[model samples]
Target: MKKPIKNLGKKLKPCPFCGRKMVFHKEIRINKYGKQVTYQYYLHEDYDIYHDESCILDEIDMPFTIGAGDANPDTGYIGEYAEDWNRREG
Candidate 1:
């Protein structure tokens, strides 16, 4: 199986919009059938971003927030998610 996330681990930059620090997160999810599990890793600000409608989610509790989600661990597969976030023009 492919890696779930990839970050060059190059130093992370502060958020340009808020000038605040960023945080990383990991999440595991199972499809509706509850037979498979998937992983996600990403970065986000230190505050609540969005709320999910429980009725629609079925059972998963993935939150929607700022930052990027890397489903693949390859350096570019999504690990670049951080690289892209770090590239903020601020």
Candidate 2:
């Protein structure tokens, strides 16, 4: 299904690579059936630089919340995970 764009805001913690601060990059809004799901993603890089820089070091799928009433009774974000996968590998 088609989706809309939304702003999520700033990051909650600092970067693990350079210790720089991460900021909210994009809010991916997807509509399934009659339900609308919103996801907030962050940009671990500068605000000016375009394109995703996180792909350089590693890919991350951080934790987030679904907007109120965005999910229907049967479907929506069923789970969440931290972006700290880098720490798991030896």
Candidate 3:
């Protein structure tokens, strides 16, 4: 069951160093028992988001991170990650 991802039009802040955006994942949907279900999704528009990448590749000091949704919803608060990233800009 491969998880699916969709672009939510959520603008990703440009990297302070490279001014580049990150990557988006892909997903596969299916109907089970006449119910639309998402089998372990990796990305959601308003649910858990997962991302851990450095603004400057290989630069651990300057990095942006988001919550991952695996067995559980580790990060489900929308706009929270962005706030954290922008806050760290200082």
Q: What lDDT does each candidate get?
A: 0.44, 0.35, 0.37
Candidate 3 lDDT (Cα, 0 to 1): 0.37
Mark the regions of model 1 whose C-alpha exceeds 4 Å error after superposition: 1-10, 39-43, 49-78, 88-90
Rank by TM-score, highest first: 1, 2, 3
For candidate 2, the TM-score is 0.34
Q: Is candidate 1 or candidate 3 better by TM-score?
A: 1
Using all chains and alpha carbons, the TM-scores for the candidates as numbered come to 0.46, 0.34, 0.33
Ranking by lDDT: 1, 3, 2
How does candidate 2 score on lDDT?
0.35
Residue-by-residue lDDT tens digits, candidate 1, 1-90? 233222422245654544544444455567898866645544334334353422222232343233444434454343555667667676
Kindly indicate the candidate among 2 and 3 with the higher lDDT: 3
Q: Alpha-carbon error at 75 in model 3, in Å?
A: 14
User: Which regions of candidate 3 fall more than 4 Å away from where they truly are?
Assistant: 1-6, 24-57, 61-64, 68-79, 86-90
Query: How much is the lDDT of residue 34 in candidate 2?
Result: 60
Candidate 2 vs candidate 3: the TM-score winner is 2
Q: Which stretches of model 2 miss by more than 4 angstroms?
A: 1-11, 25-28, 47-90
Worst 10 residues of 3 by lDDT: 41-50
